[model samples]
Target: MKDGKAGAVTELKPSRPLDHADALRAHGSSLLLIEGNGKLDKVTVKGDQAEIDTIKDGLAEPVSVTAVGGTGWIAEGKLSYIIGDNKGKDPGPFTLTPVALPK
Candidate 1:
């Protein structure tokens, strides 16, 4: 985006189609998504292609997600919750890390 204005919408082809994306949020140049199968995925788009990778799983149908600093907080359909970090060299995996919220 030049000058903070959105450019043309580009349709990217996912490595594997996200058939059950419940929640999606943009993180930098990538897109973070929660699928209906209780999987948290990080999607990176480049040109007309997008790659998908599982971050954290075994959730209870996550419905929402938000990223604070380098941590991501997910709402798992009111049953349980999970958290993770930006997984160093590899993007996914999202190992759990301690987080401090604002008052």
Candidate 2:
């Protein structure tokens, strides 16, 4: 993993599943746990738009993510994000629960 001006670059290999929580910790953050079967390729949030990489069946694509109030986010039928509460600092440890959107 490498961090650049844009963001962090992580190489994903099929040898093992990536641990979301560990990934966040590497960036000085915390992610509780993801609770769903939806496969995520990548997630990028800019302004009000969140670009999420989604994988369905065996195909992968990119889609927009929608914020749900101030605590959650949804990408239609692809994925859902439940933002964790930060006690104080903005960059503090927080939980990120990624659940699958209901069909």
lDDT of candidate 1 over 4-99, digit per residue (tens):
999999888889977578778888778888887777788888899889988877765567778888777876453223333322334333334222
Top lDDT: which candidate number?
1
- Specify the highest-TM-score model's number: 1
Tens-digit per-residue lDDT, 16-49, candidate 2: 3433311110101212222134343333444444
Write down the worst ten-residue block by lDDT for model 2.
21-30
Over 4 Å off, model 2: 1-35, 55-103
Which consecutive 10 residues in model 1 have the weakest lDDT in total?
A: 94-103
- Compared with the true structure, the alpha-carbon lDDT of candidate 2 equals 0.30
The clash count of every prediction, one per candidate, is 0, 0
